[model samples]
Target chain A: MLELVSQMFSYGFLNRALLVGTLVALCAALLGVSLVLKRYSMIGDGLSHVGFGALSVAMAMQLAPLAVAAPVVVLAAFLLLRISENSRIKGDAAIALIASSSLAIGVIVTSLTSGMNTDVYGYLFGSILAMGAGDVAASVVLSAAVLVLFVLFYNKIFAITFDEAFAQATGVNARGYNLLIALLTAVTIVVGMRIMGAMLISSLIIFPALTAMRVCRSFKGVVITSALVSVVCFFCGMVASFAFSTPAGASIVVANLSAFLLFALVGALRGKLPG
Target chain B: MALISCKGVSLRYENRLAVEDASFEIEAGDYVCIVGENGSGKSTLLKGLLGLKSPDAGSISYGDGLEQRMIGYLPQQTVVQKDFPASVYEVVLSGCLNRRGMRPFYSPAERQIAGRNIERLSIGGLRKKSYRDLSGGQQQRVLLARALCATEKLLLLDEPVTGLDPVVTAELYALIRQLNREGVTVVMVSHDIVCAVHNAGKILHMGTGVLFYGRAEDYPDSEVGRRFLGGDHHA
Candidate 1:
């Protein structure tokens, strides 16, 4: 076990994957608390599906994946917001409409190519070995930007998420902050989908936030605890992946799930949760 | 001059007239209560006053040193909004966001304002508690504290005591009365005409238009007031 662990660490690919994985995990957790509280958690899922569709098209057209997928996902997030705001279709229904359509487009593109690229499959379910040096750098830069933006507008975002109408009444631009959150979610979703898989990245966003909420009562407490839990979960999941040869994304999700269950039990025993 | 004035103001929901040709004046330090039936455009008029929505025909203007920053608002909370996962402290501090301007972090003066409001509302102990875990009464108190932190002059409350029990409602009304006595101008929308008339200096009753806008004591003799609050005087 020790030999295998050291060998995994010796490889540069594994080290880069862990670094980017931890960064993306932290960003997702920070943004997740706000998104989950605002009932916008599914935006992550929808954006990931859109990212997948864009990536598949990028692959088919022989374009750089991140360059193509990032802008496309951001645009999709904006479109989703507009549809939910202007039309009769509400948030979740609009997400479903966009997500399923994008997923279908991805599937159709993959089949049309008739060459099921292993690399594309890796993105579908996440592959640690598939993260190149460029993917690591791009992910780190974009994820760091997301983290910085969240911190800069932390209080404003809290105000918007907790009570948007009141926030607007008090001269805070709720729509602008909401749009910023949407953009950040889009960025996090695209970057995370590359490593966490399009199918399961939302668990990374949702699980840590929820687990922290079970125990932490305050928003600040929840955010701080969620960041801690997400980083630790990423580390443990990577270790598990190395040890047990499980998939990285699934392993991390399982780690987060275990943490949530443990916190739920502890919260129940402590009577922290109200009936 | 009136702190806020609405002249022939009207509001619409999806191009259909909801509030038509309504006009009223909120003078400085006056507690004005607006009462009406369920869909009587009381809230829509309040929204017009707050500039949350644009008036279709008339102009609503602010005066007597009330600008965008000088007005505080407490919106009616829906079920989902009530379950928001914020602390009393965080929620209160956010009221000072208008004063924050372009600063990324909250200044110490804002913190002082939040602390003062928290102490004023007697929610100091619950400052760190989750907003969702508090009782409905406690949540309203926190929200009031938040509104207090926003502005020292005018407060606009929309059905602020909608779901609270009778005892809590009384307490909230008493708190509002104290603020009004301290010279904080107030404008509120309510279904509880009885209690609203009891505390408010003036009453604005609307059905389709400006039914009655006069002193609370004179509302009983007015034609619209007679139809609305005929026998029931207290809530």
Candidate 2:
């Protein structure tokens, strides 16, 4: 088992996947707590679809996928937030509208240009070999920035998440912080989409937070637990994917599912115990 | 000078004029209860006073060393807060975010204020407890402490006791009264005119406009106040 683990990391592509995947999972988990609690969990899913559309455009235009996709997804995120806030469209409906439209655009663009090539398949379903050294470098830096920003604005984020109206009343820039959250989620989604796939990236954003919530009670507790859980699940999933020849993204999701169920059981048992 | 003064204020909510031509002033240490029937624009007027919404045709100004952002607000409970994962301390500390400016963290002074409010509200025992796990009454206290951390000058409460039991409701009212006695001006939106009359020194009744705004002692003599107060008795 130890030899198998060491051998898996020996491959440069696998090493890069591990490095980038772990960082992406960490960023996803931190933002997931806020997104899930805010009922904006679908924003991650929506942004991933937008990321898919941008990736198709980038592939067609022969531009760097991350460069094109990142900005495009961020803009789509801002538009999604604006549409939800300004129009009569509810948040979930707005997400659906943008997601379906972007997804259709991605399919059409792919069909017109790449015509369902292997690179497109990798983008849609994710591939372990997709990360180049440059992608890895970008993911690392972007993930670090996400982490730092989250920490720096932790209290304000908590203020808004818990009570946005009260936060606004107290002079916090609730709208600005909300936009910041959307922007960060967009960046995280774009970076994670390479390994987790556009289809599966949001799970990286959602599952760890939900799982942590089953056992943890406080926001700080849930956040810290989510970060740890995400990293651990990614590592185990990667190991399992290498060991059993399963897809990395699916394996990670399954690992998160197991953790969620396990934590739920533990929570139930704790509820039965006397104080 | 009035801490908050409104003149010919009209607020449009959901593309309709919810509050129209409303005029009032809240003096320092005044305990004002805003009472009205459903959709009468009491909440809308409160939002306007908080500067969350702009008046379409009037001016709302803050005076006597009060800034719009410095006013403590305890808004109605939101669905998002029902299952939110937050510690009591964290929620209370967030009240200080308005004073935090560009700092990345809570200052020691901010922490001290949160601690003091926690003690003030007597929720120190639950400081580390998860906010979601707290009961309705305890949650109200925690939020009140949070509001107190925002300012010593004023508090605006929106239906602060809507769902609690009668006992908890009375306790909350008493707590608010105590805060008012300590010189924190309060503007509360209430459906219970009886409780409002009991606790507030002033009443501002709304019915698409300022139906009545004056001293509580004189409320029974005012035409709108007599009707509302008599209606409360019948209900």
What is candidate 1's CA lDDT for residue A26? 97
Which lDDT value does model 2 have at B56? Answer: 99
**Candidate 2 lDDT over residue span A107-217, tens digit each:** 899999879888888887788999999999999999999999999999899889899999998788899999999999999999999998989999999999999998898
Name model 2 segments beyond 4 Å from true.
B231-235
TM-score of 2: 0.97
Model 1 C-alpha lDDT per residue in residues A1-275, reported as the tens digit of each score: 67876887898989998888999999999999988887778888888989999999998898999999999999998888676566576778889988999989998898899567786688689888767889888998999899999999998988888888888887787788888988998888888887788998888899999999888878898999999999999988988998888999999999999999999898888885455
Docking class of 1: medium
Off by over 4 Å in 1: A1-6, A272-275, B232-235
- Please state the Cα-based DockQ of model 1 relative to the true two-chain complex: 0.71
Q: Predict model 2's lDDT versus the native.
A: 0.92
On the 0 to 100 scale, the lDDT of residue A171 in model 1 is 77
lDDT of 1 by residue, B50-89 (tens): 7778988989988887886657898888655666667889
How displaced is residue B204 in candidate 1, in Å?
A: 0.7
